[model samples]
Target: MPDLPILLIVVVGIALVFDFTNGAHDSANAIATIVSTKVLSPLTAVLMAGALNLLGAFLGESVAHTIGSGIVQPEMVAGSQGLVLAALLGAIFWNLLTWYLGIPSSSSHALIGGLIGAAVAYGGWDAPLYGSIGAKVIVPLLLSPLAGFLSGYLLMVLLSWLVVRSTPGRVNFLFKKLQIVSSAFMATSHGLNDAQKTMGIITLALFTFHEIPEMAVPFWVKLACALAMGLGTASGGWKIVKTMGHKIFKLEPIHGFAAETAAAAVICTASAMGAPISTTHTISTTVIGVGASKRLSAVRWGVAGRLVVAWVLTIPAAALVSALCYWFLAVTGLAV
Candidate 1:
């Protein structure tokens, strides 16, 4: 095995890289609606989203705690730093692949899947806490999108009824202004839920290296992950943004406001509960819900079908990659 200090550095660096890609890939979740609706220019929207994402990262550590010790058994993989490295590599690979293909897949699931796969590879079937994952991770992953869809559909209906007597021009003008606030809220929630995944991974690595006595995320770890997420958000992701902003549904400013507001609410709640739900899934489904509320035909189900396929495949696919990565690392005598 390489020097402990050097391996720890490499693992932490890869973890940060994963965090950066996460922000870039998922940036569309926060800004796509506002950008598509022309409520904010792309530059202004990403800038605001990036800054708000940073602030959101500082809001809570519950999700971070969940990520660090809830999914995989920390003691089982403590000395095997390569397992953590492989997990991050798997997640980063999936993030880049989905970004290139313009699919709004779940980075949150990818990370969880990677950890599960790498843990299993390192210590067999007993390595991961399946019950904890089912209770905390899978349950929230399934329910958050459902909650977003229902909230968005109901909210859009309410907004439409409230504006029933108003002219279309007046409604559009009013929502255009309101969408900006909704978009900011969406961005903050995105950071709150997403950035903490990296914080947890880093804390896991610190524990693995005995750099920290427990699984708690240090202040420096939180700050570094937040900054990486913020910078990645600033870089923007146009490919996925095009898919999210225009393909699944044609979003008017009112629809954008409804989708962002509903998604943000669901995401923030999940973060508080220490559930690492996908902001991408929440916003995408909310957009679908808002469009369906307008008319069933308003949403392009074909595009949504493709997104669902990608979403369903994210966890298993990332797990396979991480498992392969762990095997290679072990075979190469890097699994210290």
Candidate 2:
């Protein structure tokens, strides 16, 4: 047998690469509101957001456990290290593809889809825990955006009603100040959930290698994923920032504040629930909800529809890519 540690190392490296791509692709989720509201310059916003994301990564492991052991049984794959690598390759490629096209796709879904695809490829038809996947991932993925939209719409309506007598300038000035706080909360919530995905995958790899008898995320894996995600956030991605900060809806300070707050609440709640959700999906729909609260036509539904199509396609598309990747690895005898 090959030296498993060497393969594990390579897989861990690839996991970090996936985490980096995730941070860059999803950084807009961390900073979009503050940037759009002009409450902070893009640079300042990302830096602040990145720092908070790093801090938040140290929060809990419910999400990590969900991804690490809930998605697929790690021991079933042939050369499990190779499976992770193939899966990361598929997910990373999808993330880069979507980023280049300025689509706010879900990295969480991509990784989950890749895991399922690679598992099925390696273990034939009986590898995945379908019920766990549906409960832990699919349901959360479907509901988070809807929660964001509903919360944002209601929150905006309430805020508008409460501040009805306030001058427009006063409200804008106040929300501009508050937006800094809301944006940071969103970024922290993002790190709480998204960064845990890689930490979970790496831990699952450890279990596959028998480095640990049980599936548990080590502190070192947590630190590495957190730092990688933070660095990627610092580097930033302008493409999706444009899509998120503008295309979904034009935001004034109050709109930005409302969307950020609502999305942050939904994500944090999901994180505590051990469910992995797309920060992008939540934030985009929150913006749409906030816009619609002002006027139904205020949201760019065409763009929103296109985004929804991409969201719906993310799982199947990434799965197909990872399936091909697994096939290539198997045919080459690389995973044997």
Candidate 3:
């Protein structure tokens, strides 16, 4: 086995790598609608999203605190740094696979699943703080998407009613401009929720190594994660972008504006509450809801069904992989 300091360095590097993959994988959540609606060119949209994502990362550390200490027990993590490595490997593997397949699964869930699986593998089933996981992670995981869908549907309906007397050309022209603000709001919220997950992971590792007296995130850790996520967002994930922007439903400027507005509101609220909800799930369901407000058949149920399947499987699949990773590390005598 390598020295502890060296291993600690490797774990931090991998955590940042996972953060980068997270940004690339979930960038579509921030910009897909605006791109699909032609409100902004793809290049312009990603650049803007990347900048806002960086800015939003500086907003708060509540989500980071939850991630660092809310799910796993600190005592178990104190010496078992290898388990954290396995968890990150599991998440990165899942994120890449889903990105290649153009599935916008939740990176947030993938990380949480990886942590749960690795913790169980290393320290038994009782290692995790089940109550915290149930309340902070699971409840938010289940409810945020529902909130997004209902909000999107209701908001779209309200918008349609308001514009009923307006000309189609007038509505399109008005919303095209408004969608830009909504898109920026969505991107900022995405950064706030998503970048903090990496911050929490790195801080957890530092706490494990006794480098930090407590689980508080250091400023450097936050800055590094924010930059990694921003660069990854700039690199873009075009395949998932196609799936998110065009596969579930065809979006016009009005629909894009409504969906972004609803999803952003849900995400920002979750961030404030320190719930690491999936921006992907929130945005996807909002798109569907916005479309459904038009009619039942307006949404491509077949595509939406595939997304649901991926969502349901993400936790278990990533968990299984992380468990296997932990098992391998243990067998190799590398998990201390």
lDDT of each: 0.93, 0.88, 0.93
Candidate 2 lDDT score at position 267? 92
TM-score of each: 0.99, 0.98, 0.99
Off by over 4 Å in 2: none
lDDT of 3 by residue, 104-219 (tens): 99999999999999989988998889998998888988999899999999999999999999999999999999999999999999999999999999998888888888899999
The residue ranges of model 3 lying beyond 4 angstroms of the native Cα positions read none
Q: What is the overall TM-score of model 3 with all chains considered together?
A: 0.99
Q: Which of 1 and 2 is the better model by lDDT?
A: 1
Query: Residue 211: error of model 1 in Å?
Result: 0.9
Which structure is stronger by TM-score: 1 or 2? 1
**Descending-TM-score candidate ranking:** 1, 3, 2
Which lDDT value does model 2 have at 319? 80
How many steric overlaps are in each model, in order? 0, 0, 0
lDDT: worst 10-residue window of model 1:
75-84
Q: How many Å off is the CA of 200 in candidate 1?
A: 0.3
| Model 2 Cα lDDT, one tens digit per residue, 1-336 | 457888788889999999988988999997987897789999999899889889989998999999888888766753465677777878888899999999999999999888888887778667887899999888988898899899999999999999999999999999999999899999999999999999998988888777888888889999999999998898898999988889888899999999999999999999999998899899999999999999998888999999899899888888888889988977776675
Pairs of colliding residues, candidate 1: none
